[model samples]
Target: MMKQLKTLLIAATLLFSTSQVIAQAKIAHVDTNEIMSKMPAMMEAQKQLDNLQKTYDKEFKTMVDEYQSKLEKYNREAETVTEQLNTERAKEVQDMEKRIQDYRQTAQKELNQKEEDLMKPLMDRAKAAIEKVGKAKGYQYVINSTGLLLADGPDLTTDVKKELGF
Candidate 1:
């Protein structure tokens, strides 16, 4: 009977300690997407990216038009031109096509790099604000509630936005 009583006392102590630990672990959630959308710096970065995209589109269209014009000209002259000349024209067209493809790939890479370069800092800033607010509020964990189906914890979105000065 004494051994059983001691075991019961130990189990109660462990349960009480576990409950205290659980109560001390404060958690919160924030919507990073909302904060990013409301941020003026993010919007400005998006506008810059859009302008760069437009420039690339215009240049790509010009290259496509030039390629089509050359192709049509070559096709029209294929019958009148010597076989060797026609072959040379075909090779020239192939070279132009390769160049256009290379330009498109390079432009896409540049745009991706530019977007990373421009947005990384803004993202970092938002993350830091979230972290700062979470820490200041004594939260042990701060989850991003962007895609969360259920977030019943305290929301830190407004606090993070205020921290970011937006």
Candidate 2:
């Protein structure tokens, strides 16, 4: 009987302590997308990306127009020129087309790289602010609410935004 009593006592103590720990674990959620969208630094970074994209688009359009003009000229002259000259012009057009494609691919890669360079710092700053706010609020876990279907915990978005200073 004494052994059974001691076993029950130990089980009760363990259960109580586990409950206490669970109750003390504070969780919070934040809408990171909302925070990032409102961030001034992010807005500036977006503007820079947009401008770069526009520049790339304009340059690409010019190249496309030039390629089309040359293709048309070669097609029209194909009958008048000798077979060798026509073949050479066709090869030149093919080379120009390849160059245009290569330029487009290079531009896309450069734009992606530029976006990463510009946005990485802003994203890091936002993440730090969120961490700071979460720690300050005694949150053990801070989940991003973007993908959450249900977030009944306290919201840390406002606090995080404030920490980031708009």
Candidate 3:
């Protein structure tokens, strides 16, 4: 009975030690916001997005100006024109307003799509760099510091930025 008790105690001690070693996970944190802000590719992507938005804004302004001028001309001619001509002008103005609305909607959709297309690759690159750094550095868990209330782990944002080559 004494020998049996010694064997059981030894087995329990071995199990506890193994479990303790396994529990010591290498945790790390990263601020993706910081990493992305420092990335050159992200900066270039943002510049391109801004330029695209400016182009869209210019085209939209032109359309609006044309619509306004046509409406003003129709209003001024309405007084001297025939009833049929006045009705036709009114229909034309309504059609122009509808077309403007449709164009604005389409432009918005296109801009959103363009932004998504431009951002996806940049975001994916950042994510890949973070993953690569975490694995290379033997981090079992990497948490984003952007949303963390308390982060006591070592920050890997700089490492990730380096891994991204910027």
The number of clashing residue pairs in each candidate reads: 0, 0, 0
Point out the higher-scoring one by TM-score: 2 or 3: 2
All candidates: TM-score: 0.85, 0.85, 0.80
Error of 1 at 157 (Å): 0.6
Local distance difference test, each candidate: 0.94, 0.92, 0.88
Candidate number achieving the greatest lDDT relative to the actual structure: 1
lDDT for model 2 comes to 0.92
**lDDT score of model 1?**
0.94
Candidate 1 local lDDT, residue 102: 94
Q: Per-residue lDDT tens digits of candidate 3, residues 99-127?
A: 88897899889888988897788789999
Clashing pairs in 2: none
Provide the lDDT at 140 for model 3.
84
